[model samples]
Target: MEENTFKKGLIDGLPIGIGYFSVAFAFGIFALRCGLKGWQAVAISATNLTSAGQIAAVPIIAVQGSLVELASTQLVINMRYFLMSVVLSQKLKPETTVLDKLIIAWCNTDEIFAVCTGKDYRLDKRYCFGILIPPYLGWTLGTLAGVLAGDVLPAIITDSLSIAIYGMLIAVFVPAGENDRNMLMCIAISVALSLCFFYLPYLRELPGGFTIIICAVAASVFMAVKAPVGGDG
Candidate 1:
């Protein structure tokens, strides 16, 4: 049963791995253009799984932002994962050890969490490892490839690709926002706040990391209070 479950996880994870490859490729180039070396870009992908957080960190690194700014930015952007980890933990067997849980937590990415939640049964270590392995390698290798090829690609082409790279963010929010009014409002609020931070006097001087933290936290807190999740109709 464990073997079968492991294979099932590998099969299910293949698509996610492929998706990460393409997205990580874009990020690789983006990081390269941001002045990160090839190894540094690959190292970031190897160590981190959250694409949005990684992308958000680029400007912070570029400006040599303070550790406080970077740490706060990461906490705000990746805070959802803390909640996600708590939820996903319920799927583990009671006998699951702390070490195993730590390993699984390291791999508890958004897509992996979704896949686990879609399953009715408990997730064992084997299945979690199986599911995580390919995507992890794909992400790291994709970044490496991107960095190595950055110098080979034409300047105009790489520049143009940067704009299209963020299409992933659009893909995620557009469909969800179309169907959910609350989510749409949240998206709008974040965007408006972001614009304010960009254009408003004094606010415009704020570090990029803090700007994201403020925008995201403000919109989230307002929405959480106004329309709590899972409230009865």
Candidate 2:
């Protein structure tokens, strides 16, 4: 039974692994362009498992932002993971130990969270590890390739590949936005707020990380007030 669960996790994670490779490839190229070493790029992917946050950090790092700036940026950009982790904890099997949960939490990316939570039963450590391994490898390998080839790759190709991450984000959100009104509304709100922040002179000065945090919080609050779930008042 454990073997079956592990195999099932690997099977379900295959698509996520493919997606990670494509997205992380772009990230690797971007990181190299931002002056990170090949090994550093690979380390980032291996340790962080986040595209948007890492990409955001590159420019900040290039600018030699202070530790506080880096910490705040990461906090705002990756705050969703904290919420996801809390939700995921509920989906873990009762027998899953604290250490297992800690390790699983460290490995939890958005895709991994989705797969683990989508399961009909609570997830075990083995199944969670099985699901995490392929994508982790794919992301790390892709980053390594990008870093190594960054100088060798044509400018046009690298530029084009950089757009892949945005495409992936759209792919993740669009389907749910199509099926759910609240999701669509929340997306619209976030986009509108982001644009406002971008164009408005005063708000435009805000850092990208803070902009994302404000937009996310405002949109979520609006959505909750306007369309509370579970028929709650």
- Model 2: lDDT to the true structure: 0.80
| Worst 10 contiguous positions by lDDT, candidate 1 | 160-169
Which digits, one per residue and each the tens of the lDDT, describe model 1 over residues 1-233? 33326788788678677777777887898898898888988888989888888998887887788989878878877877886788788877777899988888877887778777656677877788889887888789988878878768776765665544345446556776897899899989999999999999999987665677678779989998998888332
Show pairs that collide, candidate 1. none
Writing each residue's lDDT as its tens digit, candidate 2 over 1-233 gives 23327777788777777778777887888887787777888887888988778888888877788989878888877887887888798888889988887778777888788667656566777888889878888888988887777768777776676666566567677886897899899999999999999999999998776787789779989998998877312
What's the alpha carbon RMSD for model 1?
Answer: 4.9
Q: Per-prediction TM-score, please?
A: 0.69, 0.80
Whose TM-score is greatest here? 2
